[model samples]
Target chain A: MTVNRQIHLVSRPQGEPSAANFKLVEAAVPALTEGQVLVRNHYLSLDPYMRGRMNEGKSYAAPQPLDAVMIGGTVGEVVDSKNDHFKVGDKVVGMGGWQEYQLVDANQRGVLQKVDTTHIPLSAYLGAVGMPGVTGWYGLVKIIDPKPGETVVVSAASGAVGGAVGQLAKARGARAVGLAGGPDKCRQVVEELGFDACIDYKQHPDVKSLSTALKEACPKGIDGYFENVGGIILDAVMLRANAFSRIAMCGMISGYNGEPIPMQYPQLILSNRMKIEGFIVSEHMEVWPEALKELGTLVATGKFKYRETVADGIASAPEAFLGLLKGKNFGKQLVKLI
Target chain B: MTVNRQIHLVSRPQGEPSAANFKLVEAAVPALTEGQVLVRNHYLSLDPYMRGRMNEGKSYAAPQPLDAVMIGGTVGEVVDSKNDHFKVGDKVVGMGGWQEYQLVDANQRGVLQKVDTTHIPLSAYLGAVGMPGVTGWYGLVKIIDPKPGETVVVSAASGAVGGAVGQLAKARGARAVGLAGGPDKCRQVVEELGFDACIDYKQHPDVKSLSTALKEACPKGIDGYFENVGGIILDAVMLRANAFSRIAMCGMISGYNGEPIPMQYPQLILSNRMKIEGFIVSEHMEVWPEALKELGTLVATGKFKYRETVADGIASAPEAFLGLLKGKNFGKQLVKLI
Candidate 1:
């Protein structure tokens, strides 16, 4: 039996998660039952939603159970299988979590899928053509519904989801604007990703100053917004939104630290006739096939650009997740676990 | 020629408007030209939107021009007409301002219209069967779109718009709940209007307490909300909202006083996946004909109920309007100006 190195949640986090809250453990791989496949995970996806799972409360999904393997998306090769549908040495993408190996039942729908990484890189399954990419597409096409020539804004502009949102907005013939944490990310967002303009939010500490910057960037006014980082960024956007605007509330990364951050100018939602909606991509599984097909085509054709911040091993996942919550990671954060 | 007594806006209000800001003047009626009709105003509508117009800044429409007759809706009798569409003794509704007489041109399509009040009460055209009623119907039908067995909440429940909203919500097979200022209004909202429950906001004094009451009233959670009075009441509704809730923001009477009131817990808009939208009734003229037909039928058949708080003369408009901002006037506040 092979040894499986795994990361587990030792305790629920009170505020920002600490190194003490996670543990790295090694265990023998259990024999797979009928209709099951054993996956040897090569890469584990780390995202901001993990912070909410670490807490003992209900958010979009249930809180992570203590002492359980930390939940995540993974791309790997199937080392062994007991089911007739699968064989050894097959590559797959599944919710194998933050572990060296995972036992996935073939009958369980949406838990496992075959992947062809000949034209596309394996890591792209967890970033550009995966969950984050689908999230951006869902918000942009279904909720934001940007019209031609309308200005669309995305927060956390250089990150995986925001990058996809900007590119998708531009693809629809809309003016795409971005808001990023620092100058470097802003430059990458505007120059590399083809966004019309990018506002470096770090230069403006308060919402008032940021609003001024936003006004100068979006002279015609924001018609659609993909909100990733909430707090002052959302407040600033509220001040500049045009009549009948739509906002897709994707994530509130700033308030994931258990702080009660209040939203200001909600009355603006009324004043501007804005429509804001929160959604979970997992619950909307019906659109994944269509989204992934489009995303895969875009990435393969070099029309879509993406970047990754890869940690060395499985043990680095806790630290990488901590860095992600603090906005330390420049792009999609991942653990190259083997 | 008959003399016209008019109340003109002497100055734009800095905050809540006062009697000093209006000047009453008696002037000779202008002679009718081609397509012009002479209207002797009978009832002048005193609405909350007038307060927004009294300010120098914009809301939905342009600010009421300073030193001009206060913009209002009126039901009147056409004393004389040069137009073929209207004749003497015909009862009509028009945008006649705060004046005892108005010269209306028939060519202005939306400005004037003849009404058949033989079965329906004439004054109902300005309240339950007019702009306020249409406002309620549009918000509920177009935005809220409540499903059967869902709970619907309305703020300012005893007023014209809120009353229509609750009645219409119940008509759609949903349980209607209300929030009003005092015990009397709350009683009327529940007892007279057939709401499932009514909470007196004056007793709660804060959002936390009111939210507790809302939880008890709406065991299924609020599926739809008709926002009329914004402030603590809006905050309370936000806390009790369920996933995928919808809010139709018709008015924010509390903010009309010019004090910058911040909305609390706007994150609920994201957490609950709620959709909130602000709208102007006049902008959506396509729905008017269908809405009027339904409202007229409901009122004529006694299936729909309404109450009126009538002030004696056109001069009482300012005081009645002041009372409205303070939540003193119940139902639709109108002036009997004949």
Candidate 2:
């Protein structure tokens, strides 16, 4: 028997979650049954969607239950296995939660996938090459379906999903623009991510000024939009959108903190003849195999790239998540659980 | 030579349009050349969309040109025809402008169509069986596409498009609810138009109260919405939308007077995974024949009913249009100009 260190949600957050809401607990790892494989987690992904799960109200997915292990995506190695499929020393990715060890049934669907980490790092499985990357792929390819030469704008451009969106848009021959929080992140978006232009949202005081900035950045007017951060950014994009534009509503991290974020120009949706659709990637499992293959190839080649804001040890997850909610993390926020 | 009385837009209104903006001028009707037909106007249709055309800025359609005849939909008798397809006394519908006569070419697309008013009244081509009715059909059937047993809510319930939306939703076996200005209009929406319920927006005083009323009315939550009036009504509906709900944004008469209308819960759009699309029916001319056939059949069979608030002559059109924008007209507002 081995001792497993786990993080539990001690209390529900009122506004923004603090470290006090989470508790670190040590418990004995259960023995692997016949169909079970033991995974020793190496990294835990901290995402904006997790903040919504922490809330007590209804969102796209169910709220994360209190006093239970904090839910997350983890890339780990199969330490032990009684299952025929997964052998010891095999690397895999699964919903291993914020813990050092996860005992998952091999027969379950979407629980475990044997990950080949030869070309890319294992931590990439938790970010750009995984769910966040697939999210950008599915939203852009399926919903927006931008044509070549069309201008596409993405919010949170320096973050995992937005970075992927900008790079993918560029790969598809569309002019890509990004909206990031600060000057440094905006610079990274245009220079490192290869976006055509990046707008620093902090430089503009209000939506009107941001809209003016967007007008200057996207001279052709936005034909397609991949919305990650909502509120003023959404309103700004709407003001600058051309007729018959498409917007993919992926995440609204701005409103996740329980603040009322109003959209000022819904009439533009009618005047511009636009279509806005909100989607969750996990609910669409059919796209995963195709998306994962494309994402894996992009990451394997130097064409697709990403950065990680890594926190050492599982105990730092709560503070790291808090930082992400405040837009402190530059890219994919991850906690090194090993 | 026949004398034609025409209503010309003398000046653009700063805010809500008034009578001084229009001028009635008498001129000789142009002789019908080869392939042209001279139409004597019978009825002019006044709609909320015309208000958008009056503005100086860009809308879906071109702005109403200064000092020209006010653009509108008209059902008139073809007084003289140089084209082989038309004959004198034959009723036709076209964008005839606010004039007593119109000389149009037969080969011109969207110019004129020979309308059979044998089963339905000639004016029905302007209301339930016409442009307003087709607007509702395209918005509900094409965009919302609510399934049987789903609930659909329409704002401006007593208006032309809203009434059609409620009737069409009922025909498709869905529960139809409405939002109208006063108790009288609300009663007419439920009793005359066959909606399941009608909420009087005036009684509520604010969006929060209206939202509470919507919660009580739509116990299953709004699965589909036909947005005709924006502002508080849209805000109320968003708070009560179920997961994966569809909204067809047809009009926003509430904002036509230039008030800034903000949507309070755009986050619900993400949380509920909803889709909202804004479209113009004229741009989609392919769906007209099918939509008109269905609308005509329903109106002829009395399954679809409509009311008209008629203004006496071309002289009363400007006042009637101003009143229609203010939600003072109970149904399809028209000007009788025989």
Local distance difference test values of all predictions, in order: 0.89, 0.90
For residues B33-152, could you state the per-residue lDDT of candidate 2 as single tens digits? 899999989999998888888888877788899889989999999888999988998999998999889999988766888888779999999989888889999999999998999999
Error of 2 at A79 (Å): 1.2
Off by over 4 Å in 2: none
Report clash pairs, candidate 2. Answer: none
> iRMS of every model, one decimal?
1.9, 0.7
Give candidate 1's error at residue A317 in angstroms.
0.3
Candidate 1's C-alpha runs over 4 A off are: none
Across residues A1-338, which tens digit of lDDT does each residue of candidate 1 receive? 79999999998877778999999999999888889999989999998888878888656578889998999999999888987777898888899989999988887776888888988899999999999999999999999999999999999989999999999999999999999888888898988999999998999999899999999999999999999988899999989999989999889888887666677776677667778888778778899999999999999999998889999899999999898887788778889986
Per-candidate TM-score against the hidden true structure = 0.98, 0.97
Docking class of 2: high
State residue B167's C-alpha deviation in candidate 1, in Å: 0.8
